[model samples]
Target: MSYQSDINPRHSTWRKVRHTLSIVSHEPANLLGALLLMLFSWIILAPVMSVLLNAVLVQSGDEGRTGATEGTFTAWYLLRTLTSRMSELLLWTPLLNTLAVALSTVAMALIVGVALAWLINRTDIAGRKWFATLLIVPFMLPSWTFALAWSTIFKNHAIGGQPGWLEAMGIQTPNWMAYGYFPIVTIMVLHYAPLVILIVGNALKRMDSQMEECARVLGASRGIIAFKIIIPLVRPALLSSALLIFADCIGEFALPYILGLPVHFDTLSTGLYRAISTRQSGVAAVIATVIMLMGMLTLMLDMKMLREAKRFVTLGGKGVMERRRTLGRWRTAAAALPLLFVLLGVVIPLLTLFLSTVMILPGRFTAENFTFDYWIGHNLDTVALHNGILLTPEFWHTVWNTLVIVGSASIACGVLGLLVGYAVMRCHFRWVAAFLRQLTFLPYLVPGIAFATAFLSLFAVARGPVPALYGTPLILILALIAEKMPYASRSGIAAMTQLGKEAEEAARIAGAGWFARIRRIVIPIQAAPLATGILLPFISGIKGVSLFVILATPATDVMTTWSLRLIDYNYQQAANAVVLMIALISWAGTVIIQKITGTGLADGLEK
Candidate 1:
């Protein structure tokens, strides 16, 4: 009987389960990975599921409209969003506009970004290093900074506040040029072009000059060499950058709110914002669902394209020779193109915003008009604003809120990311490592606005052990941490992969525990990447608007939300001042991080 039981299938299965549990109990990293896998699966999937459920169910306030009991599933919201008469205004038009803007921005940004990158990395253009450094500055600023700057220069009399510089100079800028598709696309192109440059430049930097030289030796024309050899070789980066830009533009909120709202031109993001603002939770859920789907689709396509692009590898075991094509007589002229972009995209916008803040009136170039009232004056009655931004407790509160919330979220994300990396690399369970990795990366595929809506749906009311977080700062920090997890996880994973297990093994041999090994061996060695994991998310959170806009209440207002509030009150100078301050903070933070880490923004893009 004992021999039979030892050979029984049930006995064997029980033994296997016991063995696995015993192993997991002994290996702390594997145990941690298993726990993280469960926690992250819930953290990532719950909000998305909530959003989808809310789209189909009759939410509390939506019960009357849908004629269904609250929490019961109904298709009324979907029908109203997709097939009703208001669908044109609420969904289809915005959808079409979003696609159009995303595609156009991608195309224009590719052209400009590719040109600038080629000039700097491939051709011997003058000031290559300077242009490379300066161009990334636009990306450091908020995406809406360009929109605000454009408004400062081209805003017409449509909304009726302070006329823009062009209008004030008696130019009478057309509404199309001021606040609609054109400015929105142009600003997005300028803002995202630097991203394209980084991605494509990294590809170009790795490309061998021998390929181009061989093409030329075979009597290939310059255009054919570029189109056939260079472009195809860098197709992966192009596709990656294009999809990234498209995904980002489709879900951008602040730009459209600033530049497209007055003209009644709405993208999916802005339309979703309006729905949420009006308490149309059902409708907003549908819109958020669509945006999320679009973002996921873009991510899928990016992965597919990258997989296909793997067939064309530029680097191999051979010694690589990189030769820059000399522009010769045109070097100076070629240099001027990137210089012009930096001027138009970076310098002009920042200068215009600063000037607008200092001057009492728009476009007036008098010394008397240039008082520092917007920044430092006291008791100036400007529409809804009472004091200058510096003097206002509200502004300082917003700043403190931004630092505390973003800072806490970033630190948490950084530490969590390092743990995830440690688990992934050190865990004995391959499946747990894989699941945790993929789960952490899932947030990157969801649009910020859509993700915010998901959080709103999930946390608006109490769940099992969690309290309602609708009016609290904790919600913002939680959302920011989740939203920025991909960046931190990638940084941590990359850094950890480079480190060997030899030291940890030696420490273990010395009877140092797992925590001690990590504390003494891992943390000190990976400090720079740990700092990177913290600071990158911090900078991104500080400059962010879309993610926080939906989650922020008056009590939880951050810098971006505060600036939008000032805009709503028609306090142009104050709004611009707030925006300028946000920009300076973001820029300073980025500089400080770069100095600490000894890594440029472009450094990580190569991977």
Candidate 2:
């Protein structure tokens, strides 16, 4: 009897282990969720931690300055960056410049973006839909388009290059007009104003009209109603837009580098680039760390503002009427405003690019100066030229590189984003879901330049199983994927949130595994959004410059990097042609996304 009892105890324990294993093995969703969570932590968290570590650790051969051995912790970087004599030039000045440009850009964007949103959402403006659709075109194009256009028009002899159009017309463009804060702010406002319009416009559309009606009944003036009630209601959205615009501008490298480099006007992004270019790894790490800290602060502020916004929720289960204001005699004028913006932002820049491409001598508008050689002629003899752009092996190679790299990265982004969305939206464990969401979104909040720097520092050397990725195409692809995850994940989550659990649950009860359910039931229903999730990253990756410029090599030169090289070599015509091609591709992708999903790019972005 004693032997039987001992044997029974052991057998019972074995049965319990089997039962637990069976239960866990059946819950494939949980398994997949856990797997994805680990992968994200390793890929995203490791690089961030590396940047922070690099800021404090004494790198090899730095023992003399810190009096500490390599790999040892030191406060020398902090002391030198924050308190040393070069602090002003290194940290404070760039910081101030970033703030100034960001603030100025926000002020202008608010004026333009808010007014346009109000006109479209509230007022009976003429051609409202057409105007609204066209205004967002600038956002799809790169932030540097305006800067490049401005340079083409107003570039002076100060830089010793081909003179601008105005200069060729016997006009001496002033130094202030050609470059610096003014042009940088102008370009950023046009590029980012769409963000404000989208956010604030959504808020405006959902806003209850009862408060405004009551104010109207109280005999309040139009201005008074706008100042007292309307503005207050949308304040959270405006604040959110401002924060987004500031974050975008603060990390912007392309526009500032193009316009500010000639005059030594450096922002934080430019400073980081300069540090990296000069092989100052420690300084670059410190700068990247600072940028990340700033980003975290903005994120916290955004969270707080959003939390407070929840208190003022006017949309409810009740039927709320949104009354559009009559424009009376000003309808035409309101319509003209958007047309003007489009003219300045899109039409003019594209027209300038086309003109620059056809001109044998850039900025010379003479009939004799026009030639199709840059487009299709042989024996071009230009920088990095073989034949014309269409017939050249080099150009086609760049195009193929773009397709392969962007294609690979985008597919990865789409799958990961979808999985992340499913996990977060349907996760039973609340803390795990929250953690996953936050980690997935962290890459979005980090500046592109800073993120690139972190990846370079982390993967430059082989760490255990991960081989050194320096001077390789894989690093570029990895960086692109990380930076684009937020867009896809956000869209996926928005789509999944609207989906009910009934369909998925039915599949589960019918013995559907996690992968099977996702493929057959969940993804089929969300096909449009899934396609959009893939297409958004694909579009953005094709035109991405700031993230890949530092990591790109000659062998991995995509369209954007190739264009940058052409610019460096003063091949303006070829560069302009490349820019136009990029814009066309991006626009076509946006159109495809819109056609498939029945939602505009702005709608997907806002969601």
Candidate 3:
């Protein structure tokens, strides 16, 4: 009996030691993966939940609050917002207005984008090389660039400031023509259509002409063949592009912030910005949630449609290239459209910014008034201004801060994106894949303002064991990493998906460690996309203003924020110069990245 008892005790103790060892010796990849996923989930969910929490918890306006601020379990805020003041809070007025603008943009893109895509892809159009590259250039530039140019071109004397270029030429541009829905929609359409053309054109290039030929042999008219065969085939891609544009427009802040502000044309994006900037944190959160819900709904719908139809999925077979469609005499008109599009969106805006930089006065373009104070001034003795960008120490500091923030953020996002992609794609568990995919993609669904606002709460205080990230460049990097991981993760996943587990398995059989295999084999193969993954965030981070608008301090200020400050003080000329510098830098980086790495914002396609 004593022997039996002793054996039982030993067995139990052995089991305990085994459990302890298991806990201590878990794989680093798995442990780190769990920790990272948990961190991301908390960062994304906490702020959203905070909004939900505040929505329910009563705040006593006994402290004297106004608007949505006065409330307590009364449902007054909800009822009031949904009912009589619904027009203001639901912002149906702006909502409807934004919808019209969005739909108009889509319509314009469909017409213009399809024409350009066909001309470039199928026709022997003139300057095919330059047109393809220059045509979509507007897509790379910030959306507000066009809006700023529009203001420069036609001030309409409604804003009560300096007259614009047309006015300088003795033209009286009307208010409706210059400011409201007409111009806002027009600018957005031209700015956004390049995306459609690129996305749709890529699809077009891969389309099988055999189907069209099959229809033609069956006595189908050319128009019928084109409409029935070509249009239907490309419809799926067009819809996807349109949906993305819609989501983008829903989150748009700067365009409306710039163009709509002058005319009092308030979209939800602008409205939400006002709410936050004015300290209506709760309302802004609510607006943000609403916008996010809209985006989520669209995403869900798109996914559902994609699953149901499955038509958009590209077949892996090689795309059979066909004869180029001879444009006949109409080729001139076809080629001219792309240049016209570029002129409106890219060339004109660039010209405006260039001209504005040279001119001393706002609208007047002359030689004597022009000075180099903004670019290369010695003392900036031009009164009340800092010295030239080249001469100023502050500008250099800001530029350095921008590089650090963007560079660090890009690397962080690239590594995280790669890790997430590896785990989600290669891991065996279904939940891990689903959870990682959903969470990484969640930020895309959240509006940038909401996402930024949520992080504001997150890093606001140092938790008991957690360090505060506020006021540090690390905070900006973290925000950018979170905001950008969506795309980086997507590109990584796509690249890794194309490359199967054969190489990884071979390394494992040779007893190679995980890190070595990833470094030598995986990265080298996926170098272009991985590099692109870094380049994109770097460019985007350097250019981003909306996400940093709330987070920027003098210590953490980057180029975009610095330019924004200049704009706030109405230093339009200096702001223009800064923007030009930013564009040039991004353009140069894009060229370097593509020339060396051989990938672009699109995949590896040269077009």
* Candidate 1, residue 162: lDDT: 84
Q: What lDDT score goes with residue 256 in model 2? A: 78
* Alpha-carbon RMSD, each predicted model: 2.1, 3.7, 4.5
Per-model TM-score versus the true fold: 0.96, 0.92, 0.88
Residue-level lDDT of model 1, residues 328-397, one tens digit each, is 9999998889989999889999999899989888998988878888788887966566788999999999
Question: For model 3, what is the alpha-carbon lDDT of residue 26?
Answer: 39
Q: In model 1, what is the error at residue 250, expressed in angstroms?
A: 1.1
Any idea what lDDT model 2 has? Answer: 0.84
User: Which of candidates 1 and 3 is the stronger one according to lDDT?
Assistant: 1
Give the count of colliding residue pairs in each prediction: 0, 0, 0
Clashing pairs in 1: none
Sum up the clashes in candidate 2.
Answer: 0
RMSD of 3: 4.5
> What tens-digit string does per-residue lDDT give for candidate 3 at 424-492?
776555576778788888888777766777777567668578798878887788788888988888878
For residues 184-244, could you state the per-residue lDDT of candidate 2 as single tens digits? 9988888888887788988898888887898899999989988988888899999999998
Ranking by lDDT: 1, 2, 3
